[model samples]
Target: MAAFEGAANPSEAIESGYYVHAPGKLLVDNISNRIALRPSSSHLLLGGIGSGKTTQLLVACQQINEIEDIHAIYVDVSRYTDISKITTGVLTAITGLELAKLIKDSQDKNVIESIKLIRNLAHGYTTEYDPYDDFYDDGGQYIAVKGIIPKKTEGYGISLQLVETVSKLAKATFENYGNLVLLFDGLDRLDDAKAFMQVVYSDAKSISSSGIGVVLIGSLTAIYGDYHDTVDKSLDYLCYQPFFDVENDPEAYNFFEEIIQTRSSEDFIEEAAIKALIRFSGGVLRDFITLTQASIEETYLSGEDKVQEQQVLKAVDSIGRNQLLGISDNELKIIKQILKTRIFIPRTDEDLRLLVRRVILEYRYPKLRYAVHPAIKPLIQQILD
Candidate 1:
């Protein structure tokens, strides 16, 4: 993990969603097309980790802020896995510039009182706040408060906190700025993708009617394949994966180049090596970077200072054994389910999709298929026994 400190190339920062370069243009294009007429559409930007989801989202936030007089918040699902953390993060993001900008002279008692009242609507506030009580349900639909969320010991109140914050920011921003947009990210990295989607689906109607625009980003595999598979469900019914029909729906090669192009060593990463890396990584951006990083370090340790195609292949092999491929008992079940469909043959790309779907469902399980996952051939046969 530490081997690729400088990251062997320039594009690593791009992979981590910092200094967004490649995907920023594409994402901004999508937003432009959306904002032309609708201005905002609740989109579930799906991609594997390091697939530029969060980077694209942050790009969206920064870009959208420039377009409309808006109130926006971003919910990071990693920490906000439970209800409490969710509420807190949502509320915190939603408060937006409202605290320091609007309400006027916040140092003054009246402004502080106003902020306190607003804060009460959020989870942690001890003061009394019930939307049904003093607030009128006149012009727009009266937003009902979800009730007070207790402070969490670990990850409990996060979700609640996030929603509360987003709601307040949306309402307040609309009152002052005339438009609001809230983005929820990191739903893919949660403990249960299905549960996260459940929260989203349950809230979708309300989110649509709330007079606030929202853009959600997560992995389609997590939302549709992984958690849903455990319950015996199909992906078609959930939030439509926008680019499902595109031939390279996963866009692995493009995504690899997308991240790689942004890094400092554009000239150093040879085209052949990039192709090999993409093919080896099965097109996931995260895998590409990890593999690249691994390969670069391997070359360095082997006395070569540059990235070579052969070095990339060795790196890919090492990455597979060291990281990309691992299978747990639960994941073995998923792999077995996929194997049931694939007939245990590495004949076609469709088979690869099934395998990838299962792999995506659970990284814990040994993901290396008999043909794809490098090495451990003797190891898996030994374990399966």
Candidate 2:
């Protein structure tokens, strides 16, 4: 049961012997070591969904927390706020919330006031001002007095206030805990590339200038086409976690095998079943875990003690069918073309969606290549034939 839990906490995964140390750890080490040397450095982690990005972020946080004179805070943005509505202000407020908790007992009046303001703003309460009071009645109409207009708490005002609040919190953290490094886990879920870029452009400088280290998980959109140049120039480093190249890398294949064997014994699942699960997983960790769990259920339903290749195949086919539920005929044609030719050149909105949905898997081993999800391969082949 524990073995097949797809998105286990990095610490829990490590403690329970479910964590696999492969090439992915290189990313964790790079971020951790850089933050240890310079606490104010900024880093961006780019990966697709189910690429173990959250796990990598948490592990790097754990490693950075161990370094002397450094403190790491892991913030799962999705856990605390709606990612669809995320903005620079919201991110600043949530980060302030975490910093406030770290220095809850601080007696600094400025820090305390900032904490109260952040709490109020996060709860949708803003400073009140009556614009109507500034208007004067002129016989037939209301006229605005030019010199006495009240300023509303929005736009530039809110941005300045939030920046000041985060600065104060960062100062307090340094005084109490030496240095602060924030590891953000959920910004990658933002579907709008422009919105994500806005956050990076608006807040990355402010946070770095305040002497706070940052490691943010970003979506693939940031690394594709036009957005890539801007993102590459904005951050101190950009680390990518691509799908494990199991087809060409023996070590990567062995890593998946160890992940499954750690959860269930060989006696419970046959070797061929494990191989089939790996092949159909498309080198994605989450898919591999899901397939393993489904195969276990298939065996249980059939009154069998050990999972066989047939059971694994049945589980994959069922999951594949579900994957195609909402796909349109046009999308099907696109997928069919990719499957038949085994080449994917991302050029349009539909291509990006397919990449995001994991219908198309990108691999960068001997050379960059794309392929259809192996679980759904047979069905597409049937349609073609």
Candidate 3:
């Protein structure tokens, strides 16, 4: 079935009519319940690439808003600033600006003035409300505010000013909305592990101390291995979004089958064809949809009404070749070891990078397991041989 298209965020996924309420929904609800019970609780939600962290965050935001007296402010850090070099100042400013945009339509004059003050301080310009272009989902809710490098007369002192401005704005927001929840997504796009950690521990702590509930999206490396111990001490909750078990779980297989069925009729994909593609997908939702999309294109080119065994193989070959393009000799060595012994080296940057690239897939079943992506495994085996 051809209905599924990979979405970058949950809003788009829901709008696409392909969004499924998997266990991820329960995860969102649990986080919301925690925040509702303890208004000051903060959490870190972790998932690998293609694991749907952004979509989950959007769902969590919507769920949190449904709780009375709680206002949810979502700030996509990648949109407003360079996530790599994100400091306390940029993070706080971007957040304040989003809060301002959320309440700008209020009747309270003090709230409106405070929002204006936040916009001016953060953007060096006030956001002019235009009903035509500015209102009603012009791509994003907040105005795109670029990252500012404090030129001369800026540094720690400038950072202090940002913190103060954010504090003032937070006070106004709390006064207006009753309670505030910060949903920080897209932190996984940041390149530096150390920079991300610094923000999580130091900057995030300072902000949460002001009674604002926070839920941060983080990379797998930051949630597992050596960073795990460090993150454990810093967060109120560490929630892991795990991959599906395609090999043993019937429902997991059916979940993906339904995705295709939603897009096209059952007869459009043969039983063997869909199973083969899912085997190669390694249970990652994005990878599953992408491979299926390519297969559909190949079937169309071949003048076939339904995808069969041959189309799936060809699609895997194309995907495998693309994955093999830039893999290093050392990475090849690691892949070979995993293939031979079925043992994964402890978490390291190089290994984590492979997982990020989707060259490797990690699963949690009877126990933790790692495997080369099924699409690339045969290719890798042929190369190693």
Candidate 4:
């Protein structure tokens, strides 16, 4: 049987059959207006795992690139640095590599030489300098170099040096390409949401003032928590990438059906089975796709012509059991309480953790709502009983 596995990342999703238009277009329009009126703009794109935040960032980048007057530089921060242990020094090194790649590819002798000079001055830090011998090829693309910056550096001096280099590159890029926009993704992987906010709060002004627009992806907690106002004030816009509207929207169901058809026969999955999978996913795209994939396997193994209700239930039970195995007793208790009330207000790290782990799902359409993952409801009741 052909399985309906969803995209693992935005790039793959963009080239796949199930790609849909998200709210990122609004962000692109906002940035376009800002660019026409001002020298630079900085903003935030916030969402939970599988909420299509990365897809939104990719959409923004693709739309920005379509503009004749702007050159967009997309950087996946987690690729060059460790989010769990990132610090100012490490951030600088990673940011510098993205800047340096653009500069080197521009082939402007003056900018290239200036970067070399900055690299020499910043050589005292843990960031290494790999010259043309390693990065350049006949194809004329300046391939990026990847390495981690040592956590225990001599001092904070490296941060200053890296910042200076990035500023120079941003200025040069704008001079050559009319305008510049930096789209940063993968910072949400950081363990502490506050650190993600702190980094953006500290650097938003410099990046914007340098004539470089910024679109950063951050943790949902930092976007919706008490510090949300602070985040709102720090950037041009703090936008939330929403989950699917499965509960109240007919269009949502059609979208899921189309996704299944793209990878398999239209009749491969029963209509009742599809609805059950959607309800179980609670509108989280990743969970829905994953459960659908599991159901396909279960049906194929059972020699059924099409997926049935029993096979869908088996898939849901399997996923639910896996999720329950990962949480602590206290976390489970918090989730049980949320199930009892069908309400969740983020007040502590535990609350944030529950949302992050997908033990609790969030919905904004029709009204704000939170509930235990639908697939795990049976397991939760078992515990309570």
Candidate 5:
């Protein structure tokens, strides 16, 4: 039950006793502390997919909101707009919408007008105008003046307008709430590193310049690929949330076990089954939950009351097979090389793709290491043999 629930909401996860502190660096505390010390500073939080970046960002937002004279806003970009088509204007518009909610009752007419403009832009409303008179032509025939043309705003013009609007919102938030810090989640879900960089390059500085603190969730490619230096220099701070080193560190292993024990009782799931789930999860929180949930289903379908090691393995294999689907032959070759050597040098776009897909899991503590996801390891080994 509890184990099957996703920790998408940080508050619920904490209150329900399902939240476990990540070992080593505390990402949530680190980001919140920086914002608390300097409310206008910008931070970039980068991690692999399924690395709990969203949960961490939400938690940081909550902590920052508790600080005196500072208001933290958590914006899930994916929920507000299509991540595949995300742009600077869309991001600024979404920020305006969220900030507008905070100051909806404000008497400032300028802020109110800006909020309306932002809502129109976010909702795809366009202004139409007639270029010619609609009077009758020769022979008293009614003229329709072709069609009503929607006024087009140039890309640069739109960018400048959005920047001005966001600046106004930032100032209004400061005047009313003391300081505004925005935690933007789901930008990391962008299709590629180039797209992510474009979003950040276009507006991160402009927003931060308005004395608004920003925390953006970014993908692994943003930190590991060619844009790494540019991204690093653009942000005031960078926090990389790596997968837990459960296999090599006893403390991390115990932390994950605590995560499971808090969610489910041993009477329903055996200790060995929990260990197998953690081991195959490769220390990724999402996979850990997925494997546990799948294992529970496996047990239930078998008419069993408790989940055993056998059921957990079956679940792992099922998930691994699903993961292997659509993987190209060339990609399989690359994976095989990494699996054999336990060394991954991300030299090309393919390597970055592997990293993003979690086909190759990167562990930071106890020295950086890369390996195939544990659930897929046995299958890879079989192929090697």
Candidate 6:
């Protein structure tokens, strides 16, 4: 469906709307094949925020649906923390109705059939099938998105709910094609990443139980932290795998470098710039792209249109101030305060420990509590003075 993000500046973006999918070879090869969805919980697409998990999932979904005899669906599960909104988005995904089309159908289909496909596909909150339908059997009633009462699927039944919903949609999607695949997008931005993963794993478990097929996209590093105790206790048998494993390859800078060069709307960015980007970002893919994007925007401001190394440095300084300094204002303040006391926290954790050892050796010397980064030390000292 064409997105409703409104008319784009097509003239300027002949190349602007491009996006680069990163961590190239690994994702291009392993991501889609890692899981056996048949007789298994629907596969989870695991990565961190800005890890390009969504892009990978979408591509995978598109690839799967292209296969003969397979059906595919992509649901946006990130927004379904509520009853009404959940009902609307879920309904739309199931029926393939663009929000605009669903609303426009309000007058033509009366409301029910226009939304019947939507309501029928969602978990009716209380095992109740079509609460609105109680009023009329074939009344053709569609719920407005404005006042949706959200019903989140819980661990015990959430798996059943999403899988059942997808299975029904699959039947219709592949009536002619023979297989069904559903893709849920934009998960990391959801309010509770932990809850979403629980829902996904739970749904996957249920699907595995019933032997249905679905694809879940979400973050990996954050997942273990979310339900560690439960994973050890209840869900270990499900056996999930993350998309990227940095531990196996200590020399993973190449992976970071590859992500930096992923395509945007069109033009292939210079390979050298991509390498420069990976280094500039400390090997974080998302950070690398964000820095490049910001720098590219600045280049436009500087009366040029190409991203440059100097502009990138400017982007880093801004990002460092916003992310590092803004988040650690109190810590920075304390660091500055310690400087006034001739105390410094080591730039590295080890250095801080060594300084503490010195305090121990010379009891008369003031005990040190923290250390400031040498790069910022001068400014901090001046601030305190």
318-367 in candidate 6: lDDT tens per residue?
A: 76554434324555554555656856433543332333222101111122
Q: How much lDDT does candidate 4 score?
A: 0.71
Angstrom error of the Cα, residue 232, model 2: value is 2.2
Candidate 5: minimum summed lDDT over ten consecutive residues — where?
A: 146-155
Root-mean-square deviation (CA) per prediction: 9.7, 5.2, 7.9, 7.0, 4.3, 11.6
* Model 3: colliding residue pairs: 1-260, 3-263
Query: Ten consecutive residues with minimal summed lDDT in candidate 3?
Result: 149-158
Candidate models: Cα lDDT each: 0.48, 0.79, 0.75, 0.71, 0.79, 0.42
Candidate 1's residue-wise lDDT over 1-385, tens digit each? 3323433322344445445344223654575346434543455565444444665666667667677555455555444334424432332333332333454443556445545544554433333345466555444443444433334442223344345444554554466666656666766554445555554554443454445566666544443454544322321112321211111334434645665665536566778876676666654445555777777777778887567798887765555455425455654544454434633543343443434442332221123222323222233334456
On residues 1-385, what C-alpha lDDT tens digit does candidate 4 reach at each position?
Answer: 3245654665775676556643324455665566555536777877778876776677777778877888777888767545675643444454555666666866778678757755544333244344456554544433333233533323232345456667777778666677877888888887676666667776665566556777888887785566787787888877776666677767766776666666667777888898898888878878888898899899989999899888999999999999887687888788878877876787787888778877787777656788788889899889878
* Candidate 3 residue-wise lDDT, 290-373, digit = tens: 888888888999999889979999999998899889999999999999998988865777798888787887777535788788
Residue-by-residue lDDT tens digits, candidate 5, 1-385: 6546544455577667677777766899898888888999988998998888888987788789899999999887767656766655555666677787888888889989877766665564534444354542344323322111112322221356666776787778778899888888888878767767876875677777778888899888787778878887788898998988889989889988888878887668898888898999999988898888889889999999999999999999999989877778788899989877877898888888888889889988887999899999898778667
Candidate 2 residue-wise lDDT, 1-385, digit = tens: 6668665665677777777777544789989998878888989998878888888887888899899999999888877756776765555666778888988887878878877766655554433344455443333343322110012322222267677777888887888788898888889889999878877766676677778888889998997745887786678989988888788888889989888878887678898998999999989888888888889899999999899999999999998988767777777899888866877898887888888888888887656888888988888778667
Q: Candidate 4's error at 254, in angstroms?
A: 2.8
TM-score between candidate 4 and the true structure: 0.83
Once fitted onto the true fold, the runs of candidate 3 whose alpha carbons sit more than 4 angstroms away are 7-9, 23-26, 105-113, 125-158, 224-226
Estimate the TM-score for candidate 5: 0.90
Ranking of predictions according to TM-score: 5, 2, 3, 4, 1, 6
* Clash-forming residue pairs, model 4: none
Clashing pairs in 5: none
Candidate 4: where is the Cα deviation over 4 Å? 1-3, 22-39, 89-93, 105-109, 117-160, 224-226
- Residue 98 displacement (Å), model 2: 1.2
Off by over 4 Å in 2: 7-11, 126-158
